[model samples]
Target: MKEFTFELPTKIYFGTNMTEDVLQKESAQFAGNVLIVTSGRSLITYGYLPKLISIIEHLPGNEKVVVYDKITQNPKLKEAQEAISLGKKEHVQSVVGFGGGSSIDAAKAVAAGIASDENIETFLLNGREPDGNVLPIIAIPTTAGTGSELSKGAILSSPAHHIKAGIRGKKLLPRMAVIDTSYTWTVPERITCETGFDVLAHAVESYVAVKSNAFSEMFSEKAIRIVGENLPKLIRNPGDHAAREQMCFASMIMGSNLANIGTCLPHRIQYAIGACTESSHAAGLIALYPSWIRHEFEVNPRKLNHVFQWLGYDPVNDAAQAEQLFSELKTEWKIPYSLSELGIRESMIEDLADQVTGNLANDRLSEKESIIRSILKESYLFRQ
Candidate 1:
């Protein structure tokens, strides 16, 4: 019912075998050499990176080239600093992020560091604003979640700070997004489902966010349908291109949805879970979602109920809806229903709750600690 405006500037290339051409299109925005940023060694093994290099090398007037494949899960400040040093040393004109969320996020951090005079560590910790122009970044996502390919946010871990924080701004958004579903073929079935849950969570958060608008809802609505219908199917049959394409399409739409509306409880909570427990972000979300949403259920049950509706269930109430969504996802993927089984502790609850609420400056975070603890308790007890 509230009015809002939205803007998404990244040019998206969707379909099979379009990753190469999308990079070429994005290349027009930059001149000279480019930094090739990647993660998980997938580029080197699956022949994805070599093929990309072939295309980039064929282009005329492309001179400077560097490869920074030192990215790791929960990409760190040291990595960004190294990347910046390499970027400055190489004087690259652009960066191509080739991999999943970590790689794309590292690409954003690399761009942020390359564009600025200050250290990115301070920015990532305390949420500093970018004041300089960033080099063009072309994102080619090999996974379907986190939406980092199109998001302006990057999360980095710093041992010095002993915390995980995010650097966010439109400047960090990729100049172009190459989201070819064909590339997702190499993704493991478990990751496909976990990341799929992240996309599903993205749409749900975007739909009910305080900043939601008509346009954001439109994107989320379709995204929820696409992901709800396709995620489990993809898990069942990871090679199905149609389902993969639908998941990719939904991922992008969810990106747009979050751009305008932003995310709240579940995403913020998942951040703490990942920072502390090192649980897979999406899987943590899958564990915490039912509990996290319960705190906000009375706020808008019907809106959240739509998630179940789209997932082919009738949610008679909050409990039923949560069970239906989680149960179905777990059943399809054979995912366990407990956080402890995934290596989370009950003792982490108090601290995690503190961080989840402390991390935000918004009014909603002012609730009593019990409410926060209760959420984590539910997450601990959640099972299909």
Candidate 2:
């Protein structure tokens, strides 16, 4: 086994009504102001946000809370900076990331911005390291994908640079994470399917990354198995409480794996696609994964075989079975399987390849620009 080190400091509170218990216990450390960052009407429409506010309102001492609901689908650097400015203005001593990955990512940026003097722009665009003054964050994930609650990395896009970037540091990890499976019960079927795909992608990519170690792969293997067994069941019967809990468990493990070992070519390509198109993150991943598997299967077919078996497929002699499974999953989920269908054209392929080749490192996939271009083109035209 290769030598490796792992540490996850995010305290997790899990169960049906653990949200209130977790928040009450964790918020006591910050006696001053707190900022809640979220997006959309779902949390509010469902009364989760109001419930959280009620909990905060009753906290002992003069604990003030503010809400910033301006986060969008994929977080932008400008918006993160804006949220950080608000946190600073409110004099918030800590932050609560109260939605999906975007809101959580934005909250992390806000936490770093509020605690240090460095410009948020530099951190987003130039990859500047934080000064370790970040405010403590409490993560509450309404969606079971992205696993932002337990991750030390925050993904943000800059329109000016036309790229999606990540800021990573130990300080960026949330102080605590609260997982209540009930919060994910209301996720729409389509979103449920797509986000489930995201969980699988994180597991697969991290498991196969060159930087992966025994510790990361242990979590990745368990997460991969959990998502494989439970995702389709959850999609078929959205009311399966056991499946929901299993997926949440898988997502949490995958988040820790991703932070520890990082992801491979597929995730890097997905980020590049996000920079150019309005495609959902999981959709982009679904569209690209088959090609990625085809390219890498020759390097290590046993790894691919293990993944196929984990996903409940019979042992395959060739990579074609994996591609076929990919198509079947896409059709079953009603996800678009072509980049052209998602408005990413042939013209954008070169730039996408360049962006991905520049940012991501992988031992299996060739980093040659021509090979990367070919992979992107195949992913674009892969209708089957």
For this target, which candidate reaches the highest lDDT against the unseen true structure? 2
Please provide, for model 1 over 22-110, each residue's C-alpha lDDT reduced to its tens digit, 9 standing for 90 to 100. Answer: 65665565468888888748668898888877788766677756889888867878988898999999888898888888888889889
Q: Which segments of candidate 2 are over 4 A away from where they belong?
A: 357-359, 367-369
Model 2 Cα lDDT, one tens digit per residue, 23-56: 6676575568888989958999999999987888
Extract clashing residue pairs from model 1. Answer: 33-64
lDDT of each: 0.76, 0.82
Error of 2 at 139 (Å): 0.7
Q: Give me the candidate number with maximum TM-score.
A: 2
TM for every model, in the order presented, reads: 0.93, 0.96
How far out, in Å, is residue 336 in model 1? 2.7
- Model 1 segments more than 4 A misplaced: 318-321, 357-369
